[model samples]
Target: MSAPPAPLSELPLASRQDGSHPRPQLIRSTWADLDGTWSFRHDDADTGLAAGWCAGLPAAQEIIVPFPPESVASGIAEPGFHRVVWYARTVSADDVATAGRSEHAPVVLLHFGAVDYRARVWIDGRFVGEHEGGHTPFTFDVTALVADGADHVLVVRAEDDPHDLTQPRGKQDWHEDAHAIWYRRTTGIWQTVWLEAVPATSIAHLRWLPAGPAAVDLSVRLRGRPAAGARLRVALRFDERDEDLGTIDVDVPATATSVDVTVPIARQRNGQAEDELTWSPERPRLVDATVSLLDADGGVTDAVSSYLGVRTVGVARGAFLLNGRPYDVRSVLNQGFWPDSHLAAPSRGALRREVELIKDLGFTACRIHQKIEDPRFLYWSDRLGLLLWGETPGAYEFSATAVQRLTREWMDAVDRDASHPSLVTWVPFNESWGIQHVADDPAQQAYSRALTDLTRALDPTRPVVSNDGWEQQNSDIITVHDYEGDGAVLARTYADEAARDRLLSGMGPAGRRILVDGAEDRGQPVMLTEFGGIAFQPGTRRADGWGYTAATDAEDWIARITALYDAVRASTFLAGSCYTQLTDTMQETNGLLTAGREPKAPIEQIRKAVRGRP
Candidate 1:
């Protein structure tokens, strides 16, 4: 295996040996981070299982948990493709017990932030669980095998096939060398790992649906069957204040695993009418919540802390509405990659920095292209008040396996992120990647429609776009991508009623029709989802880097960018626009910022051009 290259820059957050807690929602004080170093081995011949490596690997190299072997942060730094990889770590019984696990809370859950493609986990030589998705969190209960005052070996085996189009690889490069837009591949665990101790009958998942400014429907899914007379107690409070807004208790049936509780915000409190607070880009308000499962004796069996924002998103009259008002979405396409970390952020601070940078650049929204971003980033987006278009990574080929993988992973992504108020829309496919023949193929069209319908069924509060960009199937928004550099040409192309009618009625740019046959415009909101891939290399362009349009100098870059913005802003029919990218990636130098996150153009100029304000 080739050694991994040295990282160009190391963020301070990367120095922490124990990775931070991965889950921000439903947080518990009783948990231990299982990050640091672990025993590692490469299974080239896939003989690890036969060799009984899960029991204990002999003479194995040490690797940093959560960091993939392909990353420099991983001590092994093995860049070559290893079809099978084995990792082993030992956790002390004291550490597990310290998490407040007892006869009442006897369950010890092992959580993996994410493992690439396929993962099989073993606790003390017994197979506990297996997960197939690469981008969502999974957990296994190991209380039955683990004993107090003893150490237990935890082993994991991960397998990833880059060339397998059946798997959703996202932007991870398939070939040996990074080419075009695809970059380095992530093989093993690339996120945080931790152990959480909880009561056997604890809350497993939380879903908060804010129906109105003063109403929210909260659903709690329990880990175990409810006992007789058991009830879920919920209390709501403002994060900034100590006063409790309200409290409610819902009786959970013994046969039910989940129960919904309706919470209505009080209009008056403390002898005063409560101020109407809604979450928006300018002012974000989050309501802190304390959820507890109380036994018949009024004893708390389990408890967790969570938060939610009161907001609503909808589409009406060809415009996106936020809190019942037409909101203009000025966005930039963000791939959410780091120079050192491929998919994982260097640290929590790095994720915060990315959100701050986007807000400072005057963009209200970020279209996270081709990847389900880390939950921490979504947390930051919710806290920092930035709109997000949650997008799924593209699958290149079409097949039954492709449909299964994309549908399964995409649904998981949506379910995982459905609670965040920052997420405004769900995009299942981009530019007809896996469903390329949707314009002609009935099966493909039906598949696209199925995904759209499924997304809506899962999250009806948010809009669903079956396929973003050209040749739209049934979608809530009519979006297109055009990189016409000349301002006059762009202005003329999407000019007035006649021009729009001609373009929408017939062929669009590059002789591609905007709407597929049998699909009529349903007066859905229109937005240019992609445009202005202006590459502005400070000095000379690198031989490997390329963009749709190149600028000779800073002055030329500013003029071209301003012209494109002018055209987008002048179009009365369009509701929003998203620039090609936020930062440059490997071989794609069309970002306003470099790959290292340094600004390539003047911030003020770019902001004015994008937001049409100084």
Candidate 2:
């Protein structure tokens, strides 16, 4: 069903929504892409500020927005370490102006999807705002800066310390050259930068929590204060099935910044119909909803479009359940790196293709290791029906400063991405990263538990894994990583119930205890979160490449992986298993597919092994 025409004031600034739009989860009709060529230069000596180059730069080379300087896609593909970089872009009044809304003044909001380490922005030599996180997004209200029709030169100074281990730098190498498990750095703006106009009063944030298959709770935060007798209208429909589920209208309390409303599914339907409305990897159903703020006169003051996916994710009876049904998770570890672009995907299509590729491998889920992935990737994951365990990058050291930085950024990420239906769990740390002394140190253990508790507090819908794949406490799932290539030996550990119990009690895979001492095991589902990293080169493996194990041929690779998967499936104690990786990353060649995303072996056979089928 085609959407009713949006108000002229809400005319679309872009043509498509397949990933070009940065914030796909919550979209407004007014926005523009600032993702092409931009004036850029390297600040090797950090002299840009002292030299007063914010207004403009001298002989600045061109680089692509949303692609970091270290990437080939960016015009300047300098490989060596560069600590600081700058980006300059021009935005016109039209870029930030909503069509046909002249009476009620609109505010132009400049948005950055992400930038590395730290970013300080200046508009026409005037300092605007600064943000510190590299993976999540930040926005600045630039209405005053660009209210005049004259063009505004937006300057951004991005500072990333290549050697800063205390920061949450995920898999980005500090070394000049990319090496084992670490890829090149992403400096400066690495995600779509855009502008949009909204009423002075608009929706600041929107969060959806499924109350069940039949209802959802909406946490709506207003950008500006509302007058008395204001009302919120929510309309839900499934565009794919042309099904209009229902609508809800609620009154907003005066002078309130945040409000909560519960919406029930409108039409009562049969079991099959309700099931059809429910989301799963097989169906991937999504209900599009438009939320409008109506004033006392019943005119729309502001409106935003979002989607809802009704499904339940939890652990019960020692099994992972989707919609309360047992779900055997076939998942892969995703680093989300491209050969040409490193951390930045080559294009919007690449993000969608990544999700498609994971689904193509017969895997139902992915654990985005180390990195807080791009929002566009999360958008595709939501639309395409692949489960995700959202993780933040870990800082190498534990300090009060590190704690503050990580906690702030992690909360921002949780606030930004929790609405995604595919994000089924929160994993704060991995293998005792940042909290290296978690095994023994009380302070470190508290830090880990604090993150888990904090994440649960922010978004309580999903489970939390304080630390994955090692010395874990207060984790919802007991996850262990073992590269035991011998399927028989691996099977004896995970497949045997007594061995599984013993392993959970104290003994862990690879000499890393699954649960730290004094942490009770609440009969949580056990998963071999990482295994079967068999690197196969088809003809010859790279001499410098690394994997948990090596395979000489397609036959050998398939047999080993199949045996390992069968071993994991052999256990009644096991809820799921995740393959070590989806694609080869940098110097690591354990991927089922190469870094270029080509299957090393026959795709069908690999799928069979992943699914444990004939």
Q: Give lDDT tens digits, candidate 1, residues 1-614.
A: 11111111211111111224477667766678888889999898999899898787778999887778877777776667787998999988876876546666678888888899799999878889899988888988888878565899989999988788778877888886778778788887988888877776788999888767677889888898978988889887774655578888888889889988888887532224333457888886777777878777666777777778888899998889898788999999998877667777767788888998999889999999888888888888888889999998877889999999989999888878888888899999888889888888989989989999999998889888878887777899888888888989998877766776777778767556788857887778888899999877888756556788888777788788889988988887788889988998877888999988887877887787777788
In candidate 1, list every pair of residues with a backbone clash: none
lDDT of each: 0.81, 0.84
Best by lDDT: 2
What TM-score goes with each of the models?
0.93, 0.96
Model 2 over residues 1-614: C-alpha lDDT tens digits?
11222463353321125676777767776577788999999989989999988987778999987788888889789978888988898877666554212345457788888899899999999999999988889989887888877888999999999888888887888888888778888888888888877677888788889887678889899988888888899887777868777878899988799889988885533556678678888888788888888888888777777887888788887888888798988899999888888788898899999999999898999999888888778878878889999989888889998899999999999999888888898899988889988989999999999999999999877888889898998988888888999999888887666887788887677787778848988889888889988887766855667888988788989999999988888887988888999998888889999999999888889999988763
In terms of TM-score, the best-performing candidate is 2
Off by over 4 Å in 1: 1-20, 241-243, 268-275, 541-543
Lowest-sum lDDT 10-residue window in model 1: 2-11
